[model samples]
Target: MNSRHIYHVDLAPVLGSTFQPTGFPDVGAATFTRFEGGQKVDALLVESVQSMANRLEATAWDSAADRPVDAVAGLPWVRVVRAGSAEFLTSSRLEAHRLASPFVHKATVDGRPMLDVIKEKLGLAKDTPLNRSAMARAVAGLDPFCLVHGVFFSHKEWLGQPKFARASSAVIEAHDVLRAISGGRKSDRVRHQLGEDVGGTAEGYGSVPFHRTEWTAKRIVASFVVDGELLRSYGLPEPVADLLETLALWEIRVLLTGGLRLRTACDLDVVSEVEARRGPALPELDELTGRLRELIGQCGEVFGDGEPLTVEWSSGKKG
Candidate 1:
């Protein structure tokens, strides 16, 4: 399908009406007005697209196990390990840039640098037509998440740095927002005399108080969209395409069920069922998980040997 799959869900604060929205360094809360129908409505950005992307990926990883969760157990990814030991470091699944991450590309796999391996596998050469389908397939073999979340290999040595826009993206926003101002104090129990060696505020010797601004919103919404057109453009096989889309849906399900704690004060819960704005209704989580396992098996050949492609990182190497 060339059309996009768009979904939206209503959300509410887990505790109370007042919740904290993401803030910038000096801008405080990002509040603005947008027209809905014919009237202007106050709006606040709960979470940005970039932040939501990170959250979505987090749902697929099990930090305690240092691997993909059960739902995505069979996906291929590059893993970086400490040199002289099998100690886990990082992986394409967790890295923001996926295969393009310095920790992946700058390290060595099977005695060959990953960057060089990428070039050799993709068969990149100057003055040659960029075979985007081949590039997509190659990346899919390394890390399918890169296909779903998108990636850009921007190293100077990489000829025609391949870049793919995110096939799935999401953002959380609130409407009819009201500011809730609060404050807290960091009290120093000990008092210091003028002649004492105790230092100033910078040395944690003084009581510091700070003002906090939260928000009370009439309604909050988390919107997700999967670009079917862009996904098809990758020219991936049907099974691979289905796997990526299912992974995207699974991420949304997990995030809404448990990963909505954006910050200490920004906890949220999905108040209503995930409503589809386009395409078909989302499948049940159990169904999706089962399908994922089957698809992983069907697409096994496209992925690297079942084991992760390990990169041995040594000291003094810049990554």
Candidate 2:
């Protein structure tokens, strides 16, 4: 069976033709051109790979509870807890580098440095080369999310500089894109102007006007890929591999159904059913949800029997 799964979905604004895309501070919209069927077409990057990775991770988290959502509750992840209390501070799923996050590696767990604990758990010695398969299994037990989205450990102590590439990735782009330029004013009801006495508009004492840039596209598509080949390279057991793949699909389903409101002005809705261009067909949301819970159960041994690994942390613990 083909291991790689590729999905494409058509999208459109929920209310109007114009929709705002992710923008950079100095560089507004990321606009470019590409050839399609021998014709050059204008396109705008609505969401970058890095941004989509974060969004996908967000699908599995419940911000209100500060824990994994119900569908992925039992999956392994690291938690950095308050020094003297069990309260949650941050977790692997929320950290930018997963298990390698500074908040995780720098803290102490039961008087032992978290970094040293991880190295010992992963069977890493100062002078040894990284064993890809062994480390994959070790990481799975620590933080399965890293196996899904990848992580890099650049610490000087880790001479091997181990890293994994994302097994699943997604990006959103608009084709035949056109700019929708508009402007609005931030009204100051209390004070229309302050001149130099109160630092004027720079200090927010006066009405300020700013330009807005949005886009209207002939078509918008969110493309996703799950690399089966990469997953296999990890040498994970059958159950763990299945869980990761299903977890990825589950993430996509949740994002399409409920995470479309990317920004205040960028609300979107799927215009057509998800299309799988390669590998197995996409499963229904309910089916994936049920399967994810079941798979999490089957891989209990891989995820371990302990609560989320906690590292004691405080604001003053300098690296």
Give the alpha-carbon lDDT of every model. 0.86, 0.87
What CA RMSD would candidate 2 show?
1.6
The prediction achieving the highest lDDT against the true structure is: 2
Q: Tens digit of lDDT per residue, candidate 2, span 36-139?
A: 99999999999999999999999989999998888887887788998899978899899998888888988788888888877776677866777888889988
lDDT of 1 by residue, 1-319 (tens): 3257899999999898889888889897788898899899999999999889999999999999998887787788888998789999999988888889988888897788888999877768899877999888888888889988989989876798889889899999999888898999987788533235658777666678899889999999999998877877878898888788888888877787784899999999888988989988877878878888888889976874556788987767443
Q: Which ten contiguous residues of candidate 1 have the minimum total lDDT?
A: 191-200
Count of backbone clashes for each model? 0, 0
Displacement of the residue 9 alpha carbon in candidate 2, Å: 0.3
